[model samples]
Every structure is written in C-alpha cells, then in structure tokens.
Target: MSRAPLLHASPDQIAAAARRVMARCDELARVTATSGRIERVYLSPEHARVNRLAAEWMRELGMRTWQDAAGNQVGRLEPAGSSRIDQRAGGHRGPALLLGSHLDTVLDAGRYDGIVGVLMALEIVRLLRMPDAASERWTSGLPFAIEIVAFSDEEGTRFGKALLGSSAVAGTWEPAWWDLTDADGTTLHRAFLEFGLDPGRIGEAARRPDEIVAYLEAHIEQGPELDRAAEPLAVVSSIASARRFQLVVEGEARHAGGTPYDMRRDALLGASEAALAVERICAAEHHIIGTVGRFEAFPGAVNVIPGEVRFSLDLRGEFDGERDRVWGSLSQELDAIMGRRGLRWRSREVHAAPAVFCAPLLQDVLRAGITQTLPSRREEPPVIFSRAGHDGMALGAIADVGMLFLRNPDGVSHHPDEAVSAGDVAHGIRALAESVLHLAAEPAR
Candidate 1:
C-alpha cells in the first residue's frame, strides 16, 4: 500500500518519451558545443544557450520554474492535491524527490555528460501530466513531488572550481569560495554577478533538513569499466575519492642545441617522467586511477629548452585510504624525478572529495528497475567510477544521494566525440521511472 511514481505508465509511452529525450541530447550536443565554454563550460556559448532553453522548457512544462541567484535553474512539482507552492520545505514534513545534473561540459565536451538528467526529468513530468489516453492512462496519487535542477557548474573547467552550484544548495557556499579565480584573473563571484546572478542570495539556495527524502541524478558512466563489463546502466554503490593537484616544474631556459644532454635540466622532460612515475606508482600500489590530463610548457622556440612546465594530476579510487596512499607515492615520485633531473618542482592540492555510498534502499530499487528494463542487463550491471565529477558529490555532504549511469560507449565525455547509444538511453529512462515509482510507493519517512 505504498504510493509510487506512475509505474502504470505504458511501455509505448515510455519509449516515446525516451526517444524524445535522446533526440534532445543530440540537439543540445550541437547547440551547447557552440558557446564552447562561455563560462568555462567545455563550450561556453553552447552552455548558455542550453541553460536558457532548459529554463524555457521547464516553464513550458506547466511548472513554475526559475533560475536562482547562483544561476542554478529550479523547477518544482507541487503535491498532487495542492495548487500552491508549499513553503514548508525546511520543516521536512512534506514528501519530495530531487532530480538533476549539470549543463556545462568539460572543454570540447560530448553530448551526454550532465545534460541527460535534465532531459530525463523533463520527460518524466511530461508523462505524468498527460491525460490517460495520452499518458497511456497512467496516474499515481503518491503525494510525491519532483524538483528538477540543471546545476550551473560542476566540472570547474572555466575557473577550476567544480561543483559550485550543488555546493551552494548544500549550504556550503561562501565568500572565500567565490574568491577563487581562473588563470585570467576571473573571480568566481565576479563571474556570477556578470552572469546576472547574485552572491548575496547564496543562503536562499540551501535545501531544508530532510526536505528532500530522495535525490536521483542520471549521468553517463565516464569510464571503461562499464564498457568492459558489457553493461550500460549502473546503480552506483559508491563514488571513488578524488584528489587533484597541479605540479609546476622550473628549470633554466637555454638554447636546446646549446643545452647539451650532459648539462641540461629540461623541466618538460622532468615533468613527463614524473607523469609516468605517477601512473606507475598507482599500479604498484593497487587499483588507483591517475591521469596527467593538462600540461603546458614555456619557451616556444623550437631550439630553446623549456624553462618551466605545469601539469594537472588527478588521482582517484574506490576508497579514501587508497587515494591518500597514492598521493604519497606521487609525492615520492615527483621528488625523485626533480632530484635526479636537477629540476625544481612544486605542487599544490586543488580539490578533494571523499567517496560517496548510495542509500541501500534506493540502490536496491535502482538495481531492480535496471533488471526489469533490460532483463539480460540485471546481474551485468555496470560497476564503475566517475572520472569527471558532478554536483551530486556536494549533495552527498548534506544527505544521501544516488546516481543512475547510462552507457558512454565511445567511453568518452567532456569532449566533442562523447556519445550514448539510443537504446542505452531508453534503458536509462526506464530505469529512472522504475526507481522513482518504487521509491515513491514506499511510505518511508
């Protein structure tokens, strides 16, 4: 006798809705890529256009949706029996579910990184609002409400400050956080104000205590594990811990020809050696993941030895202890490389987030739903780690959070070539609907 998401929704209706969503992903991929990082999103201009479009579409969904001072778009679903917005969310008396993801992509992002969740939420509401015939005669009076958000920042591709929007809602945003700046001296607070968002209203974005009983976010599994497992949709049990840092290597600039191997201290060469050592150290310690994704070398002359080099180091794992251990090994390798190469090296920690564990109740519901949607895919569920981060990480600080990941086959994201199978996209939609229904049906407080 539990109220649930409208499980009565027919397969045909589900398919149609999913198809529409998949198509939108394709469309947005094109549109979002154009703005190309307007605010540090992989495609700035595209991110802006997509954000505006999402807000417009949310309004069209018959829900009063608006953007907050932090630029996080918001939409509300009132209780079935009520016509007015409930102002008692902080009291945690009312029941509601939150669903969403980011709109920004990494530099040269593909179509499906954070955009899928926004599209899925829109479709779910679309089906729920349709009349029986159009809605496939499905309805649920589960006293449930859904809150959709397209978080403005997650990748921190612009100013290297990821997960800003989600962190703001979790009551963690601060002036110091806003003080962060990018390479060009673009302050985060200034960026917010320039975009017409207010830093002063940051407190208004905080979600109330237990106001949201459940949070579900859908995203592409940005890893090779799922692809290797032959599974697409994964009910994430936990998110791996991550530590990011930038290493700066300094050496004397001199004529490449003049700086003979016997006397030269090539900073770029030292940094490259350190990068491999970092990867090797991870392998030596166990299953740690490491990447030296960004690197820049100074002194452009073809014959000149580079004077300085900087690179980004990202290390992640299924547990925190392992992450820390890998960091220690990386430090050792960096020091060893600098000493042996006679180069000066230094590093600074950029960000840190612990692994997140999913709610057992909700995870089981998700696993069941994935099995039902694609029977063969049940035990074959995708078990993977998110290389790229999301706002869900910030939400983890305040409450239990879970994510449903669809297949990212080219296994690529945050790039122009990222793609998800239409069939896999359908599986994702079915899984979300099923999970939502099951969770809503339960009378758990």
Candidate 2:
C-alpha cells in the first residue's frame, strides 16, 4: 500500500496539542504512590491506573489497546484492512513502527520524564487520524502501522533492576531476575502473581525480532547542554555506557574521645576521600561522570568512631573502554586512600549497561524533520549523546532504535523542578511527527 502524504498541523493546532499533552501529564502526576511527590514504580496500583488511562485514550483514537504480560501498556493502529496476525507474518518487513517511552518513574520524579513521550505519541496518532483538507481519511492506510508502548518498569525503583519491561519485549529478560526482591522482601515472582500476571507467561511479552520495523523514543534532555545552547530540540546519537557499585569501607570502632588522632582508622574519612577521587578523576575526562549518591557510616552514637562506611557509585561515559579505564584509575585511587587510612574496602557491582547507538537512517530522518520544522535555521540540529539510561537501551537488542530530545530548563531531571516549555514541546511534536512521515516515505528494505 502507498503511504499517504503527511498533513501538517497549523501553529495554533500544534499549540493546542501541546497544551493537551501538558494537561495529561499533570493529570497523570496526580496518580502517584507518594502523597506529596511522584513515585510510580512497576506493577504497582499506580502502574495499573496509568495503563487504564492510556488504553482509554488509545481507544478514543480508534486504536486497539492491551496490557502485555510484562505489564506494558500497548496500542496499535493498523494499516486499513490489515490485522495484527497479517502484520506479524511479514517478518522483518512487518508493517509496524513502534513509538513510545516508559511510564514508570524514579522516586520523587518530575512530571515529564517519560510521561511526555507517551502522551506526545497519542497526539501524533490523533494528528495522523485527522481528516485531511478534503475531509478524507488519507492516512488510514499508510504502508506501516503505528504502535505505542508505555513501558511498565524503566526506573527499576521497585525491583532494583532497570528495563524490566522493555527487556521482556526485547526477548532479553533473565530468569535470575525472578529471584530479585523489593524493599518489602517481595520476590519478583510474587509481585507478578500479586499483580495478576503469570510468571510463566511473561515470555509472551517478547516480540519477535522480525515483528517491528524500528523503535523511536522521545524524551527530555536530562542535562544542561540544550538549555545552555538555547536549542529546543536535538537528535540523540547514543545512550551512555554505565556501571554501578555498592562499596563498603571497614575499620575498627572505638570511643571518639579515647582514640588518639594518630591511632585513628576513620572509615568515613576514607569513603569521603574515595568520593572525591571519583569526582576528580571523572572531571578530567570528556563525557565521563562518576557520582557517589549514597553514603552511611556505621554506629549511631556521636561519641563513637565510625567503624564501617558504605556508599554507592554510579559511573557513566560515552565509550565502554574509556569508562572502564576510568573505573580502574578510580579503583587505584580508592586503594591508596584506604591504605593510607588503614581501612579496607570492597565493591559489588549492582548494574552495568553498554552504550547503544541510534540507527543512522533514523538519525538522518530526525535531522531532516528538524530542518523542515525550523526552516529559518541554516545549521543542522544539534546531535547529543544521552547520559541517562532509557528504554531504548533494551529495545536496541532487537530492533533499530532512535531518540529525539526536548530541552528541559537548567537540565534538571529526576526532580520535581524538571520542566519543559509549551513552546518547546510544540516544536518537539512537529519534529517527531514529521520524522514519522519521512520514515514512511523511505523505500521498503
């Protein structure tokens, strides 16, 4: 079937669409686990609420919707006269272009992190389904169908393992994850059961490698780069590689007043020096970041010396080798600091994910879309690498992946102050919709 030409929305219409998205985001923000902050984790009642809301919106646009076994909210608008089975049988050439981002968020997350992407997708569907100037449904039978997925567990706040939802769809879910537990000591297995999901049927959520044409995600630029440059949108080049560790420092506990300064083996001091080493080392390298976000010193009494210290480290970089090399340097620094303080330390890796690059074809399409949307710009849209993890990392294993970034003021994210302007969101919607049309116009592989 031949694809229909895209029907571009007017400036006023685009603004109105953006307003609807913002309103929906605000509406979803109210459906949080915490009383005063946003905290919607995987398989919680909040997840189920948002999934129902998403399904309702999808149905309003004449799309078919369902919740996958992995708890992902899914919607599909098929090519006119085509069925899901027909699209699946087409293998790698399947007539489906997947668009979406996660719905789950970290504890105390901002409203737009993943919420904006999913809502923007719904607006795109609405725009596509609109009657053209001639009052005809020209876009009803595009060559490829559109599928939007609201992933259930990208934050890993509940189970301590990120990408659980997308990993299932990507066919990369590990059986060992079933044994993972939450803060309440509920195993993932039990959570699934309590959530009305059958663990054995979880595999049903995995889509065949050949079943999707490509995966595209829209997200906020969780950094200051775009805001500093005064750009509204950018094409994402790749997601960063990352490693996380839980580290412990051991020393002898003693009375604070009795221990002489020269005889002290302060574990807290050693851990503090290690955190500084991470900052010093990572700052010297390009696109490398290391953070010690968690810290604790054993023994509650202020009059006693801290005997043990525990901390968390999160390291990320554009390249895996560079990141790992920096880790080695940081490790050596930790050893020196501990040895000098007469303390010992060890680490357990909590998470690791290699960088994932966007497909060149998708990148080109994004650039073209940006150029078309911002016709006055003589230069190409900026391309950036994401420092934060995303659902794209999991989907990259099964299908070509791409991302578009909307600017957030001051680059603040994972916090309540995280924000995006209505003007910027309007531009993002246009660019993303144009990108979909550009991809549709490409010849079938």
Candidate 3:
C-alpha cells in the first residue's frame, strides 16, 4: 500500500567509490598509443584495448556488452532480472536512458578528460543495480532501461573531424568522410577495415529518437570558472558555437639590410598585427574568445623579410550570432591592418559548429540531483556554458541532452598536468547516481 523509502549511499562510501573511479582512470590511461604518454586516437590498437577493458567491467555489473558498428563500446542493463530484449505491450521494460562519454584521448592527454565521465556512468549503473538502491514502485522492474556508451572518437585528433563516433550513432554521418585521410595517409575507410569494423555498416549504429528517454554526460569543466568558485560540480547550460579559419598574408620578400622599416612590406608583421587585433576585439565583448593558435612564416630566414605568413583563427562565443558577429568585426580589422601594411591577405574557413543548449527539463533533474547530493551547499549549483566541443554536440541531434561538469583544480586538460581531486570525483559520482534515481522516478516525458 505504501512506497518503500529510497536508499542513498553514505558520504564515506561515495568518497571510496570515487577513488576507485580515479584509480581506474589512471589504469586506463596506461593503455595508450605511445609507450610513456597518452595518445589513443580513433580505431587505434589502444582504442580497442580500452574498449575491451570497459566492456569487461560492464559485464561484471550484470549488463550485456557489445561493440557498436561505429566502434563504440556499449552496455545495456534491462530492469533488474527481467530478460525481455524489447518492451512488450503492458510490460515494465521501456526505452533506455543514455549515460556516457568518449574514451578516446588527444595527444598526451590527462587521465580524466573523457575517461572520468564514462567511469562515473559505470558507477551510476553500479548503484542502480544494488538491492538497497532499487525502488519497488515500478511493480516488476525499473521504469526505463539504462545504457552506457563509450564513444570511440570525440577528439578527432587522427582524422581532423570531431564527433565521428557520436555522429554515426546520431545518424548524421556523411559518406564523404570515409575518404578522409589521417596524417599517416590511411583513409578512414581503410582504418575501419584495419580495426575490424565494417564502415558500410556504420548506419546500424543510429538509434531512433524514441529509443532513448534522454542523454546525460558527466565531464570536467575544462576551465577555471568552477575552480575559482570553489565548487566541485556544476550544470552545463550550453556548449559554445565555434568557427575556425586559416589566414594567409602575402607580401614581397626583401633583404633585411636593404629594406627600410617603413618601406618593407612584411607579411609576418601584418599577421602579427592581425593576431593582436583578434585579442583586442574579442576582449571588448563578454564571453567571446579569439585565439590565433598557430602561425608560421615562409622561408623563415633571419636575413630575409617574410614573403608570406599563415596563421589560424579560432573564434567561439556563447551564442552563434554573437560568435559570427565577433568574427565579422575581427575580419574587418584584419582587412584594415593588411591594407595599411601594403600586404594582401586571404582566409579559408576550416570548420564550424553551432552551439547546443541543454534541455530545461533535464537541467532541472540534474540540479535536483546536485542539491539532494550536496545539501550542505547553500547556493544553487552554478550553470556554466562549455567553451569546448563534446560528443553531446552530436548526441543532441537525436535526444534531449544535459551535462554535469566536475571541477578541475588545475583547470588544465589535454596534458598530463590536468587533475581532479578525489573528493570532487566523489561528489560527481554521487550527483550522477542521484540524477539517475531522480530520472527513474519521473514519468516518461
């Protein structure tokens, strides 16, 4: 007649579990491409190794595990002991709620970029499977199924295209991408074959909108905001829109001894000024960032004035219109600077991605999870925008998506120096676990 009270893990147990996740992250980091450093890219041997390890762990938790056509490691847990593969009329089984992040790493990556998210998802599943945590309100089993996916490619460091793994699952993969080549001259198609995957079957990875109840990802903040606020966890509002370009400045080469400073048309000087202009313009606008991350001069001779210079521009903002607006203004400044310096310049668009906003309903669910898990905190959890791209950007196409960000004490990522305290990871795990429980109790939307 009455509902049984919900069970929650103690703070001490949550902290110990968090340490396990962190230690597992370090263990997986060891399975990388390079011997001493982390460089596990898409479809590489190290990628395969990590997937195998994750699959084994998934099976240990009573979930069926398999590798999807897109090279993602997938694990599915049906409601407790029920064996129905799909839901039947008047049955308790339902569409799954997805939780996970990519396992692939960038060059010399830290132990907890994407790795921590997948581990946290696994921990959530572990909590769900425990007898004490299970709820009896659903009659036979939990209302919805639980699925964990460790995407194979999110960094795109090998193929120069991000979200390949998620795109496939979202049914947004482009056939033309198969022809893309890596630095080693291997085509994506060829690499797929080498990795024992059939590229032609990638479409099979796609899931219909109804197949998933929702998607949630746990990731590091990858910025200083959370660290500065002294908070261990936060909710993501939206991922920033980003555009990249290559700029080339052309000018006549001249001898350093013969050319006067005022008379010489130096491409390097023009490019350098353009880079400064980008910073100055972006600084004027809030939440806009423009970075000239790469630059090079032709001939590179100390005695000769540069004939040509190439540089990269990466612009990002909280909204698409704002990002584009900043780019337009920055371009005009670059045009004026090049013209005044008597140099010709051109820019080629390399990549572009629109921002993805988290679903408001899911945001409320995660917020409740954070609140219930960290009742000691007086203020509401900080909602921040992600300046970096993630697999969620692609997953957003097929399902409503939300994100939880853990604090990075050093605010560093993609390097060995990147770090997250075990205490924070414990908070992340508890929050994620609570989020799942909260979602399980809700009616299907």
> How displaced is residue 8 in candidate 3, in Å?
2.6
What RMSD value applies to candidate 1?
3.5
TM-scores, in order shown? Answer: 0.89, 0.95, 0.93
Give the per-residue lDDT of model 2 (tens digit) for 1-445: 2223254678888899899999999999999999999999998999999999999988787666788889999887765455434334112224488999988999999999989999999888877766542222226456787889999999899999999999999999999999999999999999999999999988889998677889999899999999999999999999999999999999988999999989999888889999989999999999999999999999857998899999999999999999999999999999999999999999999999999999999998888777777888878899999999999999999899999999999999999999999989898888888888888778887
Clashes of each: 22, 0, 0
Candidate with maximal TM-score: 2
Please give the lDDT score at residue 211 for candidate 3. Answer: 83
Put down candidate 3 lDDT per residue, 38-136, tens digits, no spaces.
Answer: 889999999999999999988777667888899999888776555546433112255788999999988989989999999999888776566443442
In model 3, which residue pairs have backbone atoms overlapping below 3 Å?
none
lDDT of candidates 1 onward, in order: 0.74, 0.88, 0.86
Assess candidate 1 and give its lDDT: 0.74
Model 2 lDDT, full chain set? 0.88
Tens-place lDDT per residue, model 1, 273-375, is: 9988877888776557899989999985788898899999988887899889778878887888889989999889988888877777778777766766776
Cα-based lDDT at residue 91, candidate 3: 23
